[model samples]
Target: MTRFIEIRNGRVVTPSCVIEDGRVVIAGERIVRIDRAAPPSTRSETVVDADGRVVMPGLVDLHGDDIEEQFAPRSGAETDPTTALATADRMNVLHGVTTKFHALAFEESPEDGRNLENAARLARAVDRGAGALGDNRVHARCELADASADAVAALIEEVDVDLVSVMHHAPGGGQYDAESFERHYVEDRNWPAEAARSAAEERSGMDDASQGQRIDRIGELARRVGVPLASHDDKGRDDVETMAAHGAAISEYPLTLDAARRAKALGLATVMGAPNLVRGGSLWDNLSARKAIEAGVLDALCSDYHPASLLAAPFVDTGESLSTRVNRVTRNPADIAGLPDRGRIEVGARADLVIVDPSPTPTVERAFVAGSEVIRASAGSGAAPELPARSRTR
Candidate 1:
């Protein structure tokens, strides 16, 4: 039997919105019909009065590093990965993120043990959290030329890896010149002189011939896995062109306007950090996400390192309305990722919806996933669920 959930008396917001008294009919986790009136033949099973609230489809987050934040709430500080992941998952779901892509990258590991352990732990936690009553998915952004490709392939084959990318952060090329790399290492990462010197000493051995061979091998692996590949921090048109030729369809955080322009021209979806849009510019002093959105080069906005930014982004506008800003993070990312089934309130789409009440300031009132309420106002009434127990491990 097809179950029906009738959401009536709300403004259904989408790419095009309808501010009217209406009913959204959900039949077996999919919206079967949306009409201004209830059908005469069948009585609605569940009726949720929206009270004139704005009812919209749940947001889709293509890329988010907030797991890193929850794991390491402070720099050089570590906590239980599972606990952190669970907390982050609840926070995101409550904030209206129905589909979240948590990119777990293993970088700067001199030994393979720590990287492997972290990846396994993250994969387990994501699986648990997603299976729980939350919105989360692990998108593994594996560095192709950084780690042994065999180790990475094993990870892909073993774990629930969704999205993979070919990233080459080696110095003196791809995204950073030698000078920029030095600045990023010494200044940004706060690496000591000896550590930075040791890392650079190894990269100094990679010649163009060897780099080309490595790139080709990585590209071949991506094709073999049949996973969507992305290029990170594209610096120029040539870099975009090279990656596109290698079958990468997404360019993440293009550092220069020229790079972004070339990516759009090449029919690549450009993803920018929402923190960059919220903060007004890039932390690395590169091209601003807001600027790219305003210029019409940016297609999607990811949470990057902050989960709350995804909720806060809908209220932001780059000289456009709030609805427009919301679309960039919602419908835009979904379309770019080729996920047309979700991200909208149209009939036949998933019945994931979020209701926001901005009486005083913007706040998420309630959130639902296919007629299941995940968050309610009772949490604010001091009946909040207990925080999960933390387990200790390295």
Candidate 2:
């Protein structure tokens, strides 16, 4: 039973060049051909006319935490993990994110239910929903101060974890500047200023030796599982050096240009938040992702907490070529994650594609994963489709 899909009459974007009026042929789960010639099509072969739109690689988001919003939309309300993850899959596919690493924090944020136990529950749910619309993977964000290294190791063994990142959110340094930490605690979390300060102080005062041991343990687990490891919120060259020493292959949202450059020099792929580029700067007043891009330190862009930003961030030109910008969300992250089968439109690659209408407003017209049409835009629906809206590509 051979399945065939032909995407014709589109500007097919590839790693090196964009082919105009090209056709891509998908056989089963892999792209079998790409050419200007119109290949003979059987009646059983499905055909998609791109209508002169941009057909590019589906985005690969290496780090994103938007699933937190799905499970706990409000302070006291919580949805079932299965329901929440199913909802997330639809949203991710609509935004052209064919592959997503759901960043789950293993910390004690009990008020928001983003604790270690909840993370494990969500990971198991993701494993259960493995046959969903998009490629869903778990990215464990281990808080160094949490002292849950052994628990995280066990959880990785129990679940299908794809990535791990070591994070330290002590108040005075890294991503959490003093002002930002205070605002987060007082304004966002609605905590008393004194309580916030005390918590920050407590986190900062954790035994350094214990924190180092925890990081080492998780790093070892990542190696054992053969998953990529990352460092989050690196503050400076020293921080980058330490993480690199612990076998961190990626640097997730380094707080400063110096840190990003240092990580790149040390052979770590640097990931920055797409929201920072879309919003023009960091919400927490950290180093700007756009600036990092201009400085040539930014390697890849992740949705972070907003899935929409992944598709929209590439449209923001920061002096990089169009292919390079698109690669930040596609090929680069895929390569970092060690997924060699996807992230490009080439012969023998996975048929993970995104069709975008880049005029008026950039919109995802349709998406396909593994040669199967997963999402499609409705006629006359010029605006981006909301999660509730449904359309079948076939």
Instruction: For candidate 1, list the clashing residue pairs, or say none.
Output: none
**Residue 379 error for model 1, in Å?**
8.5
TM-score of structure candidate 2: 0.93
Candidate 2 local Cα displacement, residue 120, angstroms: 0.7
lDDT of 1 by residue, 1-394 (tens): 7677677777667666565666677776788777675553265677777777767777788888777667765456667877878777777876778778887765544322225456557766875663344556666665544664555566666655556565666675555666777677667556665666666667667775765565566566666766567788888998899888877789998989999999999999999888887787888788998778768998888888776677777676567765677787788888876678777878778777777654444456666675566666542566664333222110
List where candidate 1 sits over 4 angstroms from the true fold: 18-22, 35-42, 72-81, 110-116, 128-131, 170-193, 321-323, 358-361, 378-394
- Give the TM-scores of the predictions, in the order they appear: 0.84, 0.93
Question: Against the true structure, whose TM-score is highest?
Answer: 2
Q: Which tens-of-lDDT digit does each residue in 143-251 have in candidate 2?
A: 8878557667778767788999998877765778677887887787666688678778878887768767777898998998899989988999998998898899999
Task: Note the residue pairs that clash in candidate 2.
Answer: none
